[model samples]
Target: MTSAPGTYDAAAEAIAARLASGGAAARIAAASSLFARGDAIPHERRAVMDLACAYLRLHPGRDADGEPAFDADDESVRREILHQIRERFLASSGDRWDHQQIPLTLARTYLPDVDLSKVHIRSDRFLSGAWVAGDVELSHATIECGDAEHLATLDDDRPHFQLTGEEGDLHFEAERAAGSVSLFDQLRCHSIDGVGVTVRGGRVRVSGHIGAVRLPVLTATQGVSISGLVGCSFVGLLGSDLKGEVSIDLEPALSAVDISWSAVHGDVSIFGMALDHGAARVAIHLERLTVKALHLGGARVSTCDLAELEADQVTVRECDIDELRLDGALVDGGTIEYSRIGRLSVDDATLGPSWVRDDPPARVDWLGDESRETVIGLNIVGSTTEVPPQGLIDNDCVGTMGDLLLDGFPVPLRRDSGTARSGAK
Candidate 1:
């Protein structure tokens, strides 16, 4: 291994001294041996380990003095040292080492007694097998592990993969980051706050309990996905153009939700959602929302509930609908399966052309059991037209005859010879 100028003798002497002792204690001491000494064995070496690990992690990059900072390029030495250390530590992986105040040398900066600071592991610096025990605060930092195949190599089941704070208040919030972070198994964080978080790439799956959950903001250029259960109440998704699926399982009730995008898909179970009108636009492919109320400021939806729903203009497309449905509330054109509907009601709604289809049974047959009592009422003014058994239809046909009015427009009409000769043909 390459050493920093004139520093070879001390390392060589240390290794030689351990070899001469030749025993289990000597082996243990040798595995963590360093060239410097300060009061005791393990206490002083903590600083050396921190510096060496940080230096090794940032190897290949030149130091401020233009010298090779670490010997990572030397595969033989790195492999030998790593193998020895792994063999020693892996045997008793759960063993905890109480490391006191230590200094970390990152690049050229020497951080003394680092605490509560965040570290970012970029794509190039991410080693294949990395381990940590202490709490790590990662809020909006990018930690990439590359593709799914390469990402699966992480051994999260190992007993040493713990990360907890000294005071028991650690948090991991990845809100609005551009890269990817793959936690193969369970990642336990005390609290997570993802408000308007933009996830541009990768998939996140957690099998553990989380303090809170929030919707991710997506763009046309990126995609995000999550499969987990969230326990928090406050969540926001603003200024994001979602194009992928966002699947979430919550505790049957939610407090707040904000959505603004058009490319949202999949299933979401929430108590309520506060939709944005200025920029919020989503074509709901499949959604199940049950809350006390819903407020939409500036937005459009493919389908939603009718009760406690208020918006400037909302859109409801073709999808299986249910209780408190807003089928005719706001939509340009879409199919409505009334058989699947339940407890539906509408006021000042714009009917979709696709909803007025001819059916052998009553078109209202599709309205679910809850809405069986709902009546479709209409009142039109300033028009003359024929009427049907259900309602009146305005029919004013003008041809070369100028004005020809039909007696029955919505109902069947019969041609009259007398009326034909009266310029009503």
Candidate 2:
């Protein structure tokens, strides 16, 4: 053993030959002299993590699109060695790592509310990352990320997130994962997919139990609520620009709602949306609303509120609206294409080739029928741009059919018994 002196321990081979080389500022000064060395000697930080995993197995930037750019100066030397490992070995209570199973190889640190259900996130197959600064609570917790199918991709340099999970059975198998995930209002989760994670902003309250949530680029500044979803699918929102206040509560009459394309501003409520599971029929848009039946098949909506508005198989496509309201209404069946409804309201209504307005609305207010339950199916084939004065034509008004012609009528009728209804109490 005396011969071991010359066996190349030349000060641990000069810090493993300056962490194996001269590129990227000598690997950020040998990763700040081997993780700032304050691991306080556990076989000298496991011989500097076995010479940093043997120079990451002879480095091709350690594979997976050539890693090694946790940038911003390696997140300012990994939050100053995690504030010197939380002031030299984090232990103020039951194991913050004093129980010593700390593995933050490709480093980034912040562990605030610190209830990762007895944290054992050991992802060191070759360096991923970690962060949990404030409000992290998984009450029946589990974070089991030792080799989470080789998880990576979260070096956005965002070290500020408030996380919460409650009432037992909380788990995340993390891949490109997490921060800005909330499930309050009666939060009940036993399963929420794994390893395909991306969270931007969420609040699924109203007796919330979010089962299926998928996000590609969902960013919210405030207000996101969700509740009561059963075997539901809103089909992959194509051109997505949905912002704050996204309220979804679907589980009524056997739950059916599938939103498409997406360009909402705030306040979106969906309760008991119908017909889904790939028989493929879903369209939704309303302002003043009540529903026992609504079938908007090629859906695009700004607001829909029809109190007794049971328009069966309702459909509208290419919708670009500023306003369209029909109260105390009931018109059945659906189809309308290339829509532009700025202000079209028909109160106490009845009108109906399944009531498809082949692009109607510069402004029309029929103000007929308030309440006695008899306004049957409407088919208004008119208005190139706001016209309704041919006796304000009734039998549900008619003037043109095919390229839809009707020039001027109905500008003086504002009897909105004002049934002010959108949805979600």
| Top TM-score hit | 1
lDDT of candidate 1 over 214-279, digit per residue (tens): 434333222333334334343344444545443333232233344533334332332212222232
For candidate 1, the per-residue lDDT at 114 reads: 16
Query: What TM-score fits each model?
Result: 0.35, 0.26
Residue 350, model 2, lDDT? 46
Q: Tens digits of per-residue lDDT for model 2 on 1-425?
A: 11121122345455445444445565556555664552434435433443443333231212266533343443433344334333333233342332223433322222222233322333322121222222223222222233232222332321211112222221211123223232233322322222212122233232323343433233233434555544334312222344555555444322223333344455454433222222332333343332223433222244443333443444444333334455444555454443334445654444433445354343222312211111222244221222232323223312221111123123332124321222221
Q: What does the lDDT read for residue 343 in candidate 1?
A: 30
Model 2 TM-score, all chains together: 0.26
Residue 104, candidate 2: alpha-carbon lDDT? 32
**How does candidate 1 fare on TM-score?**
0.35
> Model 1's lDDT to the true fold?
0.30
Error of 1 at 253 (Å): 3.7
Q: lDDT values of the candidates?
A: 0.30, 0.34
